[model samples]
Target: MPNPIKVVLVEDSAVAREIMQRLLDSSPEVDVVGTAQDGIQGLDVIAQTKPDVICVDLQMPRMDGLEFTQKVMSDYPRPILVVSNAVHPSDVDNIFNLMSAGALDFFPKPTSGTATDYEKLKSALVTKIKVLASKAK
Candidate 1:
């Protein structure tokens, strides 16, 4: 066995943040080192945790994920995985811009559906985290 993959989550929605935290914590291979409700707080948490990967949401107050990603790329340079509920064209375009800004991957926000849907999203996130962590290290 090895050290669990360290992760920091940056999301604005309290319910979404809590759900993600719980799901990630359920995996023994991952460790939720820290969490923040916005990008400003996220920067502090990421600095403190020094996580291998960051799960971030695009729409946040104070500092959205795009700006955060830019700052992180310029100053910190780390693997960032975007999880957003972007439905509009402009929003989706911003998500792509986030990738250009330095995010490693992007995924649509998981909807509150059936258990199977939830499980599938969880698995996808976990898999992406593992891959990103490995590549980051």
Candidate 2:
């Protein structure tokens, strides 16, 4: 098998961050290289880790995913996956902006805490990561 895909997760919510890390780590194909609480810190972590793919939240302090995506595309130029729970109408526009800014995909945060829900989300997240990591920057 090929080397596991390196990943950095950036989420403002501590609970969400931990949940995402656990879910990603459960898979053998992905490696959680680093994590951060916000986009500013995310940039620093990304620079240090040099991950193959990035998972970021849309809302956060200091910098949001949109700005972070823009900065990463300009400086590092890697495939990014936006993992967010922004369900509001306006937030859809923000997600689109992120795509235009260079983010390759978006995954909605899970709502329920059931094992089934987690399992489904985990599969989706891992699959998205694999596809994004394989994408050419």
- Total clashes in model 2, counting residue pairs 3 or more apart in sequence or in different chains: 0
* Residue range 1-137, candidate 2, lDDT tens digits: 98899999999998899999999999999999999999999999999999999999998989998999999999989999988888344676776798899998888865558999899989999999999998944
Please give, for residues 29-134, the per-residue lDDT of candidate 1 as tens digits. 9999999999999999988889999999989999999999998888778899988887334666775688789998887776577888888878988999999998
Inter-residue clash pairs, candidate 1: none
Model 1 gets an lDDT of 0.87
How large is the C-alpha RMSD of every model relative to the true structure? 1.9, 1.8
Of candidate 1, the 10-residue stretch with the lowest lDDT total is 87-96
User: What ranges in model 2 sit over 4 Å off?
Assistant: 87-92
Per-prediction TM-score: 0.92, 0.93
User: Per-residue lDDT for 47 in model 1?
Assistant: 85
After aligning candidate 1 to the native by TM-score, how far in Å is the CA of 41 from where it should be?
0.5
